[model samples]
Target: MMTHTETRSAVLSIGRVYCDLIFTGLDHLPVLGRELFASGMEIAAGGGAFIAAAHMAHAGRKVALAARIGMDSLSAGVEAQLRESGVDLRFVEHAGDAGPQITVAAVVGQDRAFLTRRAGPALPATLDAALDWEEACHLHIAEYATLHEIPDLVSRAKEKGLTVSLDPSWDATLIYDRGLLRACEGVDLFLPNLEEAEAITGSADPQVAIRKLSLAFPLVVLKGGAEGAWVMSSGRMLHAPAETVPVIDTTGAGDAFNAGFINAWLNGASEEMCLRAGIRFGSLAVQAAGGARLLTTAE
Candidate 1:
């Protein structure tokens, strides 16, 4: 078992933690203006940053979360779960603006489409914010295009001599098309899906795309859902295949993969080890109901 205060390195996760409202084993999508029966429903505290950092925390690292939540019950509940998961909540902020977004999905196995309400825009956690960048071994930002666009936070973290890992949310589609490709300069590890990688590079073949992406950064892990994940760095490409499992809900599978991959790398594992560990953890995610659910069940 791994504890939160293990002495490997420091990890800071700055991004989101929202209530993932998931419906599983659904017969079919509901027709227009009609109701359909769901086999079961489960609510879990999940988001790209939350689940990723939580798993890393469980894997023995000093982890802190930099996030903003509204003054609502669900928001408070999400915070409570993070505390239980052993993530340091010192950077967790409460704003009076919009509540945390709720992602609703009709998930069965390894894929689902989520619906989110348009709340007010999320603010950035710039260098002027309350984060203590000097007290950590590494820092990460997740799905924060709005914040990184400022160009201040990334440079500041680099100035502080902190290694950075970044996960771009779907907003990359909007940001990448508009001259945002060079944003990869400051990031150490670039995590993106196959589709996003293609969009970022305009490459029809993702295998060729990963090689080009790694030239700018030390590593690039193009996450493919069923094909596992592929990594390219220093002119070498490695592939990690996924395990066959009875998938219940795959809402957070990719997030789990990021957690497993980064945690191994932070612990001084080789790039090859990181990719395999990531795929191993992600395979566990599918067998469970939610992203974080696999943590308690991991051997």
Candidate 2:
């Protein structure tokens, strides 16, 4: 097992912990009064924070998960997978109302859709302990919803001298908020997928969308799926093409990409290198049924 605590490069990944029920290789998406069958299924530990932390940990980073997990049977289903992730779970709270936090992900071809149930509150009770964790140097907020629930999170992390990164995980309601950019004011890095970027910038064009996002963030890296990724920093922009790999499931690929980019960025890697690392991780993610599944057996 990888050692912890002795490493001062720990990352605090804050978000909700979920039990992901994934279904892949479907004939078509289910519609009203219709039934669909999937060729394969898997139960795994999920949520943006956990998935990113797992991938980072697999890459040899000392990552700690700061989130809430439910005590229900549904939560039990993912317990072994969570423990196997190699993430520091000390900061994870097991609360009654915290879960049954579940996501039903269905994938068809390269497209996917999710139906999720969010329980209790978005912010975890361990926020104070996590922010004050002596080994932590960076904070990775998993979703915009978490930021929306705790608008002052970035400031809180900043006050503790920790660099912060935000991934605007798609929330239908919060994505269109006019104050979204304002809510992200103190974030050091902004990672958003193509759809979220277009929604935020009101531009379907990737080039224009990234440019608009770059103006607000010091570092903006946009995940463009098969087209690869784009990064803008200090008025300079760079793009890295995606790695070719078979697609098994697209679930959590963006979050996996975040881990690669962050791991590289924390090491003071060049902007181009960070983009390539993200692509590499994302490509690996799609070759499996769940976000961190490949990392479980990865060498």
Candidate 3:
């Protein structure tokens, strides 16, 4: 297995952070004006960046998270959880008065719906200054919106001699914008789920979307939940099947996959090996109640 010492690299993840209130064991989503009961509920440190960073840390990777969080009672617990997960929090900044960003995730079987209330601006002025680029071998941006906010992020990372990866987490507004395509320029790796890829490229087919994305980025990793994932690298295409696992919540599965793939990639593993690592991590993610809970004990 790949370890932090072997890679000698730390993953720097940037994006928003949230306190995820997950309700699991729901029979189905609630209809309008109706209330439903869930068998279990838990609050966990969440957001794409946190989940990915936590999983990376769990895999013995030196990982750091850079984001803005409110300095409130709710945020205290969330921050503690992140630190306990072994993610370096030196870059995390405090947003005063504004409370912690809270997300209500209603999970039913393998699917989930989220309602979020962001506390303040996604990025703080201290973000860029806080980043220790010298310590980062790879930078992972959790969402396309964050990239939009910092247009020079990829170029800046490249200038620092760090490879960059981005997961275009579904942004309803930006997916239809052609500017989204331009935002991906110079990114070493682009990861987007099948649906997000289709929306961004205006293509109904995953293959077509992958082809279009491959033209923009050197590597394109298309995540297909149950069908597994597809990797397009250097004009070559490869597939990795998903590992069957009991479903609990699908909240952070994709982020976990990102961590696994990146850990393997940093270790100089093959494309197939990276894909398999991703599937393995994703499988573990869904077997637990919270987003990165399983990662805390991951091997």
Candidate 4:
């Protein structure tokens, strides 16, 4: 049974969670016959949902993670971190098929590459309960893949009277899907990286891609690495420059930005302020090797 709350202050974040193995400071990517050495490595609880939720919680926003994780050894490896992330985990479903989801990230210079494996269904059993939680007025879908897996999620959340946001996390297979706009029909906010926007809109021009996207989504925020971010809404386009910071690893920087932007937007911040907040969070993300590193020292 879900109980109603007076304040709609919490955010419900839905997506998959993974145990991330991050390697930073590599000279180059690994070749077929050659093994590359990295200067540093860290194992952390990751995934678009977890990373963004962690940051949101770190920023003093109440967040609930509604996703699935495995009940396996790999899941055990990240249990401690997840428990300490400060994001509510009551909605996380632990099942045999959900275990062993993993992402291996290799960072060389300012660029990074990832190899990932996803197991089980993306939807969690507690999804409906999480959505019905009275404290949550907003729903953040961490990845387009999750939206694809649960096509009616946006409408379902909207039916519950919660505003919805979606991040089109880069997926080689789904980036070019012609049905993307349709799948995101009821999303209030659409966040995408420059590459994703270009791929989806089939245009190298960021402005053109964003303009086209704005026609579908009420708000469009495009994350541009190094070049900052762009926002399109209500027939207006806004741009914010990213801060130049020392680069360590860029594994989940975009997701961190999503947290900052979403949090501010939910709080009624101006468009420019939201972009600035996102840039601030993203700057902190690249200063460390892992996505949730700031939270380790947040308090």
Candidate 5:
């Protein structure tokens, strides 16, 4: 198994995909004996990887996705949407193990509740194609793919002088030791939210957590909703406040933020611009009904 090592400036994101089924206008929390009416209902493609990839592609950047989908009709629909968005879809594989993962979300006012079922693990592809990744500028991966599968990808990317970004989804109840830090040990930037930061550093302060993380990673971006986000890099911490807007849904704000920040960074924008872009993307996502429609369909 051989993976290509190149320092192209394009973004390659790998993560999960699920169908977003939402029902809006729940007047009250329904009890087991009660029937309630939903003001609206919508279905859209979403999930961590698909949304991020869509955002990057929407900004007119070269984006590719390494994801798994079911072989059923839902999977076919997802593939069609990805193709229409101009994302490089050669790496998307369909799984025979499980059908597509479907998320049934109920939106009440600004809050939502969801239930889901997944058929199998994210589809796996041969590394032969990554060996063909001669022009990828960066590699962004998350919970969708495990680190063991891409053990050599980071080192290869480092050798080619590419920026590496990682978002690790950790097990919350596990014992904290050296392994946690090592999850994102060698990368240019690490993005985690308030909760993840606290679990890793035993501190709730974004500033304090990022300051400590900065020693290991040259750049650290911690996201905090309403209180805004913080970027710590080059010995400077910047305040990235979220714009005032009516909160509709908070499904994909983080993924949207990641896309916006990285997209702007690659365009030579300042840290502020990167953050603002991320916030704007988040705001836009909240306004919509689903996390992925913003990227796949014209808004």
Candidate 6:
């Protein structure tokens, strides 16, 4: 564990943590009752919060991760990986039994699927403690479920003079909730992939969806994998082209993008520069088998 130090611009990220079992080099997804073989496999600490935090740390930003993990060997291995990535884990808590684990099968040039099992409930208490930490200048809500579990988190973060961002990493049930916009009341930035944006705003057109969301959040960043990313802020829109890369897996690409954008934003970069930074990080992330592995190596 790294010793904690007070920093003026540290980022505190809160969400679920998972030990990811990533399998790559698959031609296609397996059918029901069928077995599929992958050419390579990698184990890494994953989760939206952890991935983003690791990338921020790699970028030389002071970042802390707050999540609940199990005391089991798998969880211990995940923690070791995170610590190696330079993320401050003093806020991470250990729960009963084993932590959440996800087995992801990523098909080359295609989408991936996940099979996840969670051992306990959301970590609202851990999140609250991290918010009270004075070192954090920015707060990132890594998943919508965490925000849902702690409804007042955004408001609480703002009250502490912290700028907040949220990546509503896809949720099947909560995306349709009409109160989703209300839940994001005080968030400074709202990041969502194309699918999640359309699902939340019920608009097929990306522009319409972003426009609707921008009304709620001061800045709205819509991530389009491969195609690129879009930023809607104030009354203007900005686009950043995605860098061409041979993608191995896109497991945590969006989370990496969030880290880039947030890191740039915290440093007072222009919106265009922030979008480019995000695209750069996301492109690099997909070139490897797992999200945190490439980032840790880069660091």
Off by more than 4 A, model 5 = 1-7, 27-37, 108-114, 148-153, 159-161, 169-178, 295-299
Tens-place lDDT per residue, model 6, 7-109, is 6689999988888888888888778998989888899889999999989999999899988888888888888898788899888888764464555555566
Query: Alpha carbon lDDT of residue 18, candidate 5?
Result: 75
Error of 6 at 207 (Å): 1.4
Query: What is candidate 2's lDDT per residue for 72-135, written digit by digit as tens?
Result: 8988777678888899988888889987988999999888999999999977888899999999
**Predicted candidate 1 versus true structure: per-residue lDDT over 8-104, tens digit per residue:** 3678777766787888988676679898888878888877878887777777667777777767888777667777888887777777564766878
Which has the greatest lDDT?
A: 4
Candidate 6 local lDDT, residue 176:
85
Q: The CA-based lDDT of model 2 is what? A: 0.88
Count of residue pairs whose backbone atoms collide, per candidate: 0, 0, 0, 2, 6, 0
Q: What lDDT score goes with residue 24 in model 5?
A: 73
User: Candidates ranked by lDDT, best first?
Assistant: 4, 2, 3, 6, 1, 5
The local distance difference test score of each candidate is 0.73, 0.88, 0.85, 0.89, 0.71, 0.84
Ranking by TM-score: 4, 2, 3, 6, 1, 5
TM-score of each: 0.89, 0.96, 0.94, 0.96, 0.84, 0.94
User: Which ranges of candidate 4 are over 4 A from the true structure?
Assistant: 1-6, 295-299
What's the distance in Å from true for residue 175, model 4?
1.0
What are the runs in model 2 whose C-alpha is more than 4 Å off? 1-7, 296-299
Per-candidate RMSD vs. true structure? 3.3, 3.0, 2.3, 3.0, 4.4, 3.6
Q: Which scores greater on lDDT, model 1 or model 4?
A: 4
Cα lDDT of model 3 by residue, 100-210, tens digit: 789899998788998987776667566665454456788899999888888888887777767889999987878778888787788888889998999888886878889
Measured with C-alpha atoms, the lDDT of residue 214 in candidate 5 is 83
How far residue 71's Cα lies from its native spot in candidate 5, in Å, is 0.4
On TM-score, the stronger of 3 and 4 is 4
